[model samples]
Target: MDFWILAIRIIFLVQNTTGIPGNFSLLFYYLIVYQKECILKPTDLILMHQMAANTLIILSAGVPQTMAVWGLKQFLNHLECELILSIQRFGRSMSICTTCLLSIFQAMTISSRKFCWKDHIVKAVKYIGCYISLIWVLYILINFIFCVYALIKMDNKNVTRDFGYCSIIENDKIIEILYAALVMCPEFFFSVLIAWSSGFMIVILYRHKQRVQHTMSTHGSSRNSPEFRATQNILALMSTFLAFYTLSSISRGCIALLYNHSWWLMIVNQFISLSFPSFGPFVLMNHYSNISGHILVWIRNKIHFILF
Candidate 1:
């Protein structure tokens, strides 16, 4: 293999190695260790589910792309190609939906008490599993177009460009446009919802801070206030997710518009697309007190043991 190709494969491997394990650790910590110790909070439940979806996104898209880079592209049969494309679409849609739901849930939690939906929103936390299952069903239906058009590439010299592993073989421009709209509509809608929820949460938090300052009490510490801490974490989480998500979107748009002529564009496109799934777990861990603190303490002990 060429040095540059090897370098690209190594980069993909490193990203998956870091992200997959981190997300699994968080999942185990929340669902197993933390659950055994105490009741899981509603937000933790959302985080746990989102981590599961993130792990799937990495496995379905990142792992296969890495294998393709390592010369496994030609080995994929039509069935495998269709499955990979379908799962990739499913994972992408689910991630967007789950992240949007998380933001909306947090916003609803932090809304002013006078808000009309406040009580109903609080009661709806118990049905998180139902909502998530509905999201999965909706995205699965939307991504069925993947299986319809996905095909394995043949090694014919006459073929000019190969998309590698799997290619969408649709020729009807109208059908292609409709399929693209189906895939993008949910994403665009969810993004708008996330932005509104995050903005609303910020406004509520700002007003609350002003009110607290007017009646400042020595007993109240920002760190000790659960609402304040949760608000900060949600804002941090939203900002990180939106930044990565937007980068991925722009990279994908460019790749599509420019016809993927340059190898560097493909690399940049892949890297940006993988950014959220690969880096999001660590971001969530940073905002999550227990998980971050536990990891830090474990690292400290390992270092102490190593030195002694």
Candidate 2:
């Protein structure tokens, strides 16, 4: 194996084990394990469903690559390749849909009290489950031809190869332009939504922080309630998650554009690819105080129990 190929495998392995599933698990633990006493809200369910989708995204990409790279398994033929390619295509399609749902959900949640949508949030949220599922099926269908093409004869090493993940055929400049358009369009939209939602989150938290500081400095009552504190923390966490996603994607895009087959450049790209998934859990842990504390204590206690 080439050194860079070997390095890329190592990078992706770490990413698969931790970055991808860890984030989903964090959210899973919060929704199913920790917060079971509370009735699950529609938004919570939607977000958790999205988390599930995110987890699937990692599995679809990582499993095939891991198997291929480690030589633990082999496709041996195009039939197996089709299955893997289809799965990855589905995962990515679902991720795009979920992201849109997340942004719209956030928008609904943040609507003005007097807005027409405010009253609809509760009722409409109840239907997100069905809607998201519908979108998943639709996405699968849309990507069917694309995935099948991977299993077909293609000169593009990126999409059809031993690499487990395939790339688009660079030979087709028209398709390349289309691919770039597809990537940049969604990225641009998501960037805007993330920025818009983050602006709200930051402003709210900033004002709350000012209020707290004023209360402390001027001897006012510490009126910041537990719920408010928790809410603020969640907002901060969401903001960080968006920021990490944005930066990682930007880095990936730049590298793709600038990649010149240099070892060092390849290493840097491998590192970013490896590190991308880890950001999700990091953002979550940084934002949610209760969950973060619980997980830390849980891990420490587990370690101590094992040792003693």
Candidate 3:
């Protein structure tokens, strides 16, 4: 195997191995283990949904791509190809929407009582499940457009363009651009929403920090506070999502524009695109106090049992 191809396989192996299990563990912890401890909060529900989505997303796109990289040609049939891509895209969009909702919900929770939407926002959490269901249906409809264009053709030796295991044969630039726009429009909107909500939370946190500092200069007290930690987690979540999303978008755009598409570039683009989904669960889980604490206690008990 070529060095680059070997590298791609290693990357995919590590990513799917780690990401799939990590997401499943998170989903199970939140849905089952954590429930044994306390009632599921809206934030926990959102994160659980995101974990499930990320797992499916990785399995749909990452698995097939990996198989193809190892020289398995036409890894998917026409119907399977279209279905996988549609599901992957749908999962990705749902992840974005849920992240945006999470940020906005956190902001509302931390904002001053005087804030205009305080009461309304408080009520919104009660209907989070309904909202999540609506988002799932909406994205499924939005991505059904993929089924129209996605086709499985025998891997042609002469063809150099590598969109995916499947192919889209669009000769017209206008139609291609329109198709791209239709696919990306929802993601762009959700990205903007995440940014806005994150920004609002930052302002609120900054003001709160200033007041806390004025009262007491000790860093430990302020940093260890539940509210402060929640803010940190939200900021980290937003940063990771935006950073990976932007990099992936740019790389994908370059792939579209380049006449001679470099396979390495596409592989790199796939890695970047998969970054947030694959790693996002770990990020939130690390910062979530209750979950992390429970994990630690469980680990210590396991160690104790083994040693004794």
Candidate achieving the largest lDDT: 3
State the lDDT of candidate 3 residue by residue for 1-308, as single tens digits. 48877888888878888889878878767765665767678887888888888887899888877777777767566567668867887888887888888888887777746478767776787788899999888777766755554342223223434456765333345445655676577678888988888888788778777888876765445444676677788789888998998898899889878888777798888888788878887787777647656666777877999999
Off by over 4 Å in 2: 1-11, 20-24, 27-39, 64-76, 96-100, 107-117, 149-184, 215-219, 223-237, 251-276, 285-308
Worst 10 residues of 1 by lDDT: 150-159
Global lDDT of model 1:
0.74
In model 2, what is the error at residue 217, expressed in angstroms? Answer: 5.2
Ranking by lDDT: 3, 1, 2
lDDT of 2 by residue, 121-238 (tens): 7766767768877876766665665555543535455532234333333324654564456545665676677567657656665777797898888995677765445455545545
Runs of candidate 3 with Cα error greater than 4 angstroms are 37-39, 148-168, 171-182, 218-224, 289-308
Q: What is the C-alpha RMSD of each candidate to the true structure, in Å?
A: 5.1, 5.8, 4.5
Superior by TM-score: candidate 1 or candidate 2: 1
Per-model TM-score, in order, reads 0.82, 0.67, 0.83
Ten contiguous residues minimizing lDDT sum, candidate 3 = 151-160
Model 1, 229-295: lDDT tens per residue? 7877877878878888888888778866775468767776776777777888877677775886666
